[model samples]
Target: MKRTVLLLVLLMAAGTASAQVPSPSQPPTPPPMPTPRGEVLYSCPGGIDFASTFSNDGELATLRMPGQPDIELSRAPSGSGFAYSDSYYELRGRGREATLTAAGRSMRCHAAGRPGEPPRTYAGGTLTVTLFPDGTFRLRDRREGAAEPVLDVGQWAQEVEGGVRMVLRGIDNSRRAFRELSVDKLVADDGTELRRTEKTDPIDGKFRLAGMYRDAQDGGLFTACLVGRTYGVAPGGAEPELEKAWVEATPSREASLYVEIIGGFDNNNSITVDRFLTLKRDGACPALVFRGSALRDTEWRLVELDGTRPTFTEWRRRPLMRLDDAGRFTASTGCNTLAGDFVLDPDGLRFVPGPMTLMACPPTEAEIEKSFVEALTAVRTAQISGTTLDLIDATGKRRMRLEARGR
Candidate 1:
């Protein structure tokens, strides 16, 4: 009788548990969906229109073009507005304006639509620009005959807070080189011109130069890479910090360092280093940086060979080496052109010389060319940093140094 009573109590407890549980028709709640970020279509030079999709945090932009791969650019530092960059491209924008620097080409772009902004005419300095709400623009050269308007139709975008930038598209990309206009003045449709009330700042007569600085016996000598000119430093004209910076940048005596300074040229064509702006330990020229050349498929000119500087020749026809993705390379030996194959593995890099041209050259040129070819064969590894490519021998010594000059 007691065992039966215990069995009935256990059955009653199981029935109470089943009643307390929720029904099968009720399901658990799910998470909320993420809100979508906006997208913008931009019209660029050469009729290249692209679309940029932004992330929710505004830290990433994915660019999409018709025939090209999608590029993901991360947010980079900018003085105003936004900037994004990857290894190959740089995109900058403010308001509805965007500009892309890719493949050694700069193209200005504007977003497709602006709802509140209507078609406005801006005229200044014999040029008239009409910007429409659809982001298309028409620019006319008023300097010519009044009977005909030389129209340049393309895209327009907001450059800054109060400025609008218009880019001209050329037929066959002829006039597309650096052809842009920034209009700050507004001309009403009724022909009334509106100018800014604020006075512009006066221009400063100072100039800035950045290049390699060598502490020579006479004084400090600088080679401006962009202009490819050498200038002597004015004695006692530099700030005390400039000397300190040079000493800090150079680890040993007779070392060449990179420096940037601001000054004006004196009567003797020497620059006075009035202000020291920057000092990098080993920095490449700004020209090469702006060229945007990568390691592979880039033509690199031999600047230093076997711990000696190469003789100056024709600037454009200097000895260069080009490495392709197919493990093949072609190089100019200052006398003969050589074609070769190379190997790149995790262990190191090696070059195997193949066919070469046998050209008669002067004694000095022939000797230099012979040494260059031998140096290539001796290269055991390669190192690339910034705009420089250094070839090293088995002894870990740098045998040759090259700078990226593009194709």
Candidate 2:
């Protein structure tokens, strides 16, 4: 009887404890992050934005900005967010969307998709070489209807004589058959030979080959359809120098880009191969500009200060100004460089000028630099109309004018 009574008491206690104990509280659900598929528009902190297409497989991506080349991205390190790459350019993810950071801007975007074929998706697994008679070559992944070459020689090695040598180490997925290429002889089928001169030997001298679109300068910008060349001049010869040639470029600067091919003698392999030369000439416009919006990441050149434009004499390059979406603004006076911060709001724009870099330049360039900084301090408002960007002061007068390049 006592044992029965004790068992009943224990059962009653157990029921009482159960009644007092609290059930586990469920955790709150996070807001749903956007699906990483389809067309997504990303905005940078500077109010500048761009659009791109993300593949449904959730890895491949394609940038779809007009006037810009489509950048293809493969998968990156995993997260609830995803990242994709090609090194200098990349895409990352955060809270509700991912970010594509290109040319130094981190733009956040919301992604969505459809059941259609991915615009950036391409058939991989083939390799091809694009060689010109001038001996300049490009390495590309053979794809169906690829608008751009996968790999150009400039992306890897220094343009040298006999061409540059590169090795593919451990990447198995790379375009196969990329190895040392042995060129027996350079033929004239592709214009490998430059005009022979009495004083210059094709292999050891300099030539001024003209190109299209002479470099230009607006305010502080060096604008040009400038082409960069590298020649493997006799490896150990005194460094090469630039000299005037029978080439001149203006209006359609095509004549400015003259291909000067030379034959390189390799002491290591006892092989003679052809190489090319690069040119540096004084022109106008520099291609590097601030991109995006005016109050955003757009670069500005001071084409005119107040009511007039300054004329440059020695170096036709103009003072350049590039402002990124990050509110960071940089200015060059054709000599020294200056930078500062800018703020944008519904009330308009304002500049919080910063320090200038200290460097000695020619008297003319120094004077131009001083003028550029002085003009920047007067900026209070700004606007973008078509391809023209203008800066106005607090008194509502135009302070500077710039033409947007490569927009």
Candidate 3:
């Protein structure tokens, strides 16, 4: 009886101790961060926002807008900044600013960064301004689509009441002071507004194309390294300099030298040389051989026939070819199909024609098909440059050109 009574007292004491101890409380949730105003990667004047992400190679950008489905766009040739577009919508961005156009309506946007940050670069109307952390500044004035700057100078700068002041020292040692509206801007004393811009890579702009320059009877030929296009150097201010450099580098009648130049496109098949850079005797395009083995299993579209571009009325009427792992191939001859067996050994290639369908074709298409088959039969080696394929004959002449489809 005494033992039972002691156990009952111990249970009652345990219950009292448990009741006196409080339960552990949960941690308080953190408050959500407030989104800053005017921080729109894709925004409108009324405060609408949108988002976008780019592909790894920067070839595509997908956009997401409020109350709308996602849209994907392919990168297109642009004169400045980055441009992506489709049949319906177009988007262009430079530095931290962007503009989107849809259905003839345009909207401006700002990336997610506060303006007026120090140590920044800004550009507008061919003027580029850069601020340094050591209280120094530089300005460059160059024309659009040109690399060589017309006016370049290092100057002194300091933070002022509203923004920053830049002092320029002329050739006569006379000092001139100017004020910028903001750190993110590059403005002149005359109130020319400059927008923020990022520094570009050496090969990123329209100028600064490095390639191989070969002298030809009709002016010259320039095969760009990264661009992978052979262009006829149009007569311009830099033509005389280019010829001089070529003659100096190689006096031989048949000369092929590497060169760099600042220029823009004259047409689809030629480039106007604005400035000539340098010519190297030992330089070659390294981008050609890097992806040579990538030919197999890829859909190839015929781009050139016997060193000339082939024209087709419709895209579906163009020639197409594909090589398989089993050493066999199939191709489209614009109107019929052709099957064959192929042998690929390192950089060499041989096509053994198997069978082909004889279908009635238009006169122009028939002539193109005849040349195309002849060129393929003459191919003894292949050279690849990114998405381009050049089929060369035993004599080292490029007879046929193909490109990876859908590129």
**Least accurate stretch of 10 residues (summed lDDT) in model 1?**
27-36
Per-candidate local distance difference test: 0.57, 0.40, 0.57
lDDT tens digits, residue span 36-68, model 2: 566554323222233556787877877533112
- As for candidate 1, its clashing pairs are none
Going through the candidates in the order shown, the clash numbers are 0, 37, 0
Error of 1 at 394 (Å): 0.6
Candidate 1 is scored at a TM of 0.31
In Å, residue 92's CA in model 3 sits off its true spot by 19
Better of 1 and 3 by lDDT: 3
Per-residue accuracy of model 3 over 1-407 as CA lDDT, tens digit each: 32233234233323301122221432122222122221123323233345566666778887644223346888878653677898667777553345666655555543322222335576666666654332223456677777676443222433222223544532223344556444455556667677766662112124456777766677777755542334568886798899888988885645568888887655343667888888889887542211111355455788888878878778877897777657787888786667777776534678886667666777877788888788888888776554467888888888888866532
User: Which has the greatest TM-score?
Assistant: 3
Candidates 1 and 2, the one with greater lDDT = 1
User: Candidate 3: which stretches are off by over 4 Å?
Assistant: 1-293
Model 1, span 1-407: residue lDDT tens: 32233234223323201122333332222122122134565544333455677787978988754223346888888753578888567777654456666544556554554423445665555555555554444455655558754445433433211112223332122222211221345543334453432443111235566767766557676655433234567876564567678877787655557888876556575667878899888685532111112344455779998999977556644677876657787788775677768876545678897766655666777778888888999988776543467889889888999875421
